[model samples]
Target: MIHIRFSDNNYGGEIDLSGTPGDLRSIRQSIIKLLQAQDVQVCIPANEVKPAPYDSCLNSLVIRKSDCSVKVMVAGSSLKIEGTPEKLKVFADWFNFGDSTESGYHNHFDYYEGNEWVDPASVSLIISCKYRGTK
Candidate 1:
């Protein structure tokens, strides 16, 4: 299963996929594609804004990936977004947020004479976003 979390205080999400290796790879690729489609960027805070100010601004998205999972974080000042989980889900689904299905396999025995083993298949994603205030 995969889980995603988003917060204004520190925007981020977590993905948990404990299953086949193929599924994990597919999911990872899907997430990368999704972010690319949204044109996500890495936000850098300005150097003049005060800390804990109440306002709205456009920030960038920071994405980090590993073997098991991937994480997405966004940072900025006065970052307040209006949207609940349901709303976000709707938007994600509409944009093909998590959709992928491609599988393949390799056999070492084909070349190693008698070496054969199955590779582990699964992926997880954890994302977090931190806002920095200006001086």
Candidate 2:
């Protein structure tokens, strides 16, 4: 499964996902579509747009890949989300609040190479985000 975590100072949240490849991909696509559909604007260094009303932003994302599963930690407003590798990838790609680019978000697809559950073919992912206010 994939997981997401959002944290700030004293608050946090998480989301978990478990399903087949198609389901996982669909979930990820939804998140991306939602962000694109929103009226909010993202401020990218190259293409800086005006901030939106909600000011939703993606702070950080941590992706952990394992032999049998994936974990995603998103630290934003103390919110967390979990799901499969495919789903997590979708969230990572579309994770933009008021900014077009995030600070410390990355994907580690070979984290479980030397461990006991190590499987060269197995793949997973994790994500984390940090927000400002309450959800």
Candidate 3:
């Protein structure tokens, strides 16, 4: 069985994955997909838009990668995201959110509503998971 224990200042839990490689992969994919679904499409740099006009200026995202939120440390010009491998992919997909025309990117959840680059909208994501270990 795959065992994972987690803890944080407020909340935490343990997740156990038990199954074949393909089953584990499916589990991971499901987890990431669930997380992708939680994010709301916030207009970046909300100033350019007219209707909202900074009304819903959501410039930050609290990405709960796992049962326990991982710690992101920004030291100098470097940054660190520390957590389980499965959890990391959730954040990875969000950061790479964009359209196909945007080179070197994968469309995970299709968060980009197509033409968002020029239309001032948001909807984009990409996800992948490789199951490791035997449980």
Which window of ten consecutive residues has the lowest lDDT sum in model 1? 102-111
Candidate 3 residue spans exceeding 4 A from truth:
1-16, 39-87, 90-135
How are the candidates ranked when ordered by TM-score, highest leading? 2, 3, 1
Number of clashing residue pairs, candidate 1: 12
Candidates in descending lDDT order: 2, 3, 1
**Residue range 1-135, candidate 1, lDDT tens digits:** 221222233322222112233333333444445445544322222222222232222232223222221112233421111122233222233222222322222111011223222112211122212212201
Q: Which structure among the candidates has the greatest lDDT?
A: 2
Candidate with better lDDT, 1 vs 3: 3
Q: What's the number of clashes in each of the models?
A: 12, 51, 8
Q: On a 0 to 1 TM-score scale, where does candidate 1 land against the true structure?
A: 0.20
TM for candidate 2 is 0.24
Q: What's each prediction's TM-score?
A: 0.20, 0.24, 0.23
Model 1 residue runs over 4 Å out of place are 1-16, 39-135
RMSD of 1: 17.4
How well is each residue in 79-126 modelled by candidate 2, as lDDT tens digits? Answer: 223444444444445333233323233334333546432233332332
Better of 1 and 2 by TM-score: 2
Q: Against the hidden true structure, what lDDT does model 3 obtain?
A: 0.29
Worst 10 residues of 3 by lDDT: 42-51
